[model samples]
Target chain A: MSNNYNTDGDRMIDCFLNLGELMLRAGAEVNRVEDTIRRIGHAYEFERVEIFTINNMISLTVISNDGRVYTQTRRVSVAAVDLEKVARANELSRQICAHPVPLEEFKARIADIAENTRHYGKRMRYIASVVSATAFTVFFGGNWVEALISGAVSIILVTCMLFSDRLKIRPIIAILVSAFVMTMCVQGVTHFVEAATMDSIIMGNIMLLIPGLALTTSIRDVITGDTVAGLMGICDALLKAFAIAVGCVSAMLIFK
Target chain B: MTYLVQIIAAVFSAIGFSLLFNIHGRKLIITAVGGAITWGVYLIVFTQTENVFLACFVATMAIMAFAEIMARIAKTPVIILLVPMLVPMVPGGDLYRMMTNLVMDNSGQVRFYGHQLVMEVGAIAFGIIVISTAMQLILKMHAHITEQRRARH
Candidate 1:
């Protein structure tokens, strides 16, 4: 029994290392990144696998090997070196293999992300910048109020995630932050435009925030016969569309 | 004459923008050249006949041809060059028009215009994708030949 356990543990570590390499090759493809992460998570037999965007603004969908899926939005920061966090999650997964993990560990994990968000902040900043610029340009037409709103949201998200650097939160937090920041910036821009009745040409530019890449990539992936990868990409694209709508509606409701 | 300036600027801007976006390799030059040709064709056709569709079709063909030439010459990813050049031409304005019309709850002609708007935007995306894909195929064939040559050497 002891020997079997040792061999399994060794295999799990090897699998995770391989997954890390695959992720490096995938570049900025979110589906490829998530798929790689899922491969690692599966090696450990994790019940719930999720990659959070670092901004504490959006929590991506939860993917489980059990074929169950759920999505949520939350502020999760990476506190420090998340190897320990992964180790802890591994332990919980093992415990739950025989019995369900205590809710306390989940709570602690959430708290950890909140506590050490800064180390993850810079990693998140780049993706956020791309997204925000896309959204800002698409929705708002060089309006100061729109700029202020986007700037405020960016600052708030960065400040919130800055606490977790010490905890070494998961790198996936960056993706979440990017998505949220972009959505917020677009919404902010749209609101400012509507308020000021800006020109359509300017407002059109902000539509760059739309995940046209994801949409096209998903189509490509599906055509290329990578169904799992394609599905994840499709899910991401759909979620962003939903998020854009939500942000726009929320801004409308709040501002009005 | 002003159209000529827009064409030159578009081409130069596409190249400059690619550099600004950190896209490197021969594909960038190809994309810039392609954008210039496309712009020129559009200007010429539009000026001569004022036929928007014909001009757009000619521009698309130029872009497609340039993409193929660049991909083969540079031996790099076609998308790296194609996407940036297409950026200026994306039908963002149409999307905005559609959304505004929808928001305003315009019916009849407004609704008809909205549908047209969608088709135009989709056409831009479809055109870019199709042209790039065709270029990618040509590049793949070119790559195969180069591989064969290298093997013989």
Candidate 2:
């Protein structure tokens, strides 16, 4: 969604590249992204297709029916955990493979999937953040009092996340800043809350920020032998984990 | 009380995650129940084997297989259910404790928890690889058997 470049080309190749870029941004594994592009290209009457995908870049080559070669590389954005987007992209790609569409229609459908599919409303997202963090607090053996505090702290965290997202902030800075602010808020509140340990509270909220998608996707990529993509995913997860740790440690130090 | 809390918490965590991921309809319920099953299986195996890695490995294989079956029925990608199903298996509490130990300069505790974390992650990766490879072989055998039948006929 960041860069829409090179609108003029074999529209069929454009659709293939667009779908690949969408799938990658939506956090599909590298294999899945490459598979989607190849399938879509062949379905559109391309004589042959070859694809190479990593965590953040996808390059594809298609030999059209006339044997003209069209090669395109799309720079993918950082992935997020919207399985809905992935599922939708997968379904769309499959449908196109079964019954190839005109390039114009293919482009439109891909754009619609990118923007207009029903996402969980903002309210639902906020509630989910609270419920998950609170349940995790109890699951982590926190007292009810600590669990309650974790719930309140999650709202503040979610707000920070949404605000940063709206302002188009980079994900790394958003994560690092939110983790620090949330931990500082938790520490400040627990000081007066009598017997509410900071450990369980922080543990519960940390679940919200953990790199679940990157970790899981990386595992799959590695298992599937996409070692480069897998390594990139691992690196991304490590950086995010480090940011969270630095944030927590700094906040704790502030109180110290 | 503790068992009940653990099961319910696992389910709710899955629900929360499913919603956050924008998963809709029956997929949401299946993914949430999948989380509870994962926790239940992990607890049973861990208590019996007293091995963290073994427990995680078994639990992961169980859930991934379950997701594969459900995905076939629902005609959705397996990752939809598989990812959220594994949420409860992550030791968020232990991870936080490890980071805290690092902050406090408790190197011994850091090493302990860090080792445990790596093992759990390794279990998940290996379990997934083993099952997927097995599934592929099964499919290949099935295809070969059908081909043989056609040739015989």
Candidate 3:
């Protein structure tokens, strides 16, 4: 156990686990996460690599050149979708595959990503939130006034979301709180606006929180042979959607 | 006129979701166009077929193929392009209506919206499964052929 071989094996396992955790947190699909880890292990010249990954956890095993076996597992935090990070991680994985980097360099790279990852600015995020709510309102048959009002209210909801996200609140509770806040805001605003009804405004904002696309992607995951990953994703999405419904309903009832 | 508005709505909505997803630059334009393409195809097919399921299925397949091609060309993962592009197609209106009916205690309306939601979501899911599986097979077969040629050498 004192030989250099064990140290190298331990480092390799650490690097692979780091890569897997990065990809999972960046919102890469389960298939992509498993595939990237396996590819990286092969590139590093490991004898055997096996990985089982679902949305919340990744477990990996590798056999070294000298018959040393190493395994590591990581719990992924509930990720907020950040495609820029996904692209960066995808690019890093490809770079590693093309030519393996030292364990230190790989670990440094992961830390660099964590520290210096770029994000859309707060101003742009606010604008995007406003525009997204506006367009969705119109898309769902709301008129000009309703769209504008929904857009205005969305910033408040977006702010709430940002706060909850920073606080690291659980997703279900965050969504429930956000939905309740959003419905409450919409109701208060529409009362003065007169022309705009609560339904269209609420519908527009709901687009921001509903997990419709996630639900669809989960089934696709199942079809692609990632049954566990798919089921976990499905349950997570269904729960979030239900939270939104419950929050909205309870809020509406309170005011009625 | 309404169709034109819907298409434009899609483009902006895609842009918004792309921002929320932390995507920036040229890829943003790609998702924007992909959104218009998605709704445009969905409209054309839906009008002709008068079948919601078929409309969603064809629309999703078309845009997914677009996403795959764009990913290859841009050297980005397909999901980056695919998810934002697909965001506009989500049944937000239907989901809202369903919830509304539930609150109003209108069982009949809730059931109607629920069916629509399931059909739309199912069709899109099936579309993604079929096209992605097809793509995977094609890539695997190509790799196998390449290996065989190398072996011969």
As a TM-score, model 1 comes out at 0.45
lDDT rank, highest first? 3, 2, 1
TM per prediction: 0.45, 0.95, 0.95
DockQ of each: 0.08, 0.71, 0.84
- lDDT digits (tens) for residues A75-192 of candidate 2: 8777556788889999998898898766678889999988987888999999998999998988888889999999999999999999999898988788999999999999999898
Question: Residue A235 lDDT in model 3?
Answer: 90
Query: What tens-digit string does per-residue lDDT give for candidate 2 at B27-100?
Result: 99899889899989988998899999999999999998999889888888887888888888876666788999
Candidate 1: misplaced stretches above 4 Å?
A: A1-197, A200-207, A217-235, A238-242, A245-256, B1-21, B24-61, B107-114, B121-153
lDDT of 1 by residue, A1-256 (tens): 2222223333333333333322222222333334444544544355556653221122344444445554544332212222222323333334434543233443454344334422323544434433343333333333444444444444444443454334455333433443344445555566555643333323322333355444555555565555665566567765764454444434334444
Q: How good is model 2 by TM-score?
A: 0.95
Misplaced by over 4 Å in model 3 are A1-7, B144-153
Task: Score residue B141 of candidate 1 by CA lDDT.
Answer: 99
For every candidate, the chain B TM-score is: 0.63, 0.96, 0.94
The whole-model lDDT of each prediction reads 0.46, 0.84, 0.89
Evaluated against the true structure, the overall lDDT of model 2 is 0.84
Pairwise lDDT winner, candidates 1 and 2 = 2
Ranking according to DockQ, highest score first: 3, 2, 1
Comparison by lDDT, 2 against 3, better one: 3
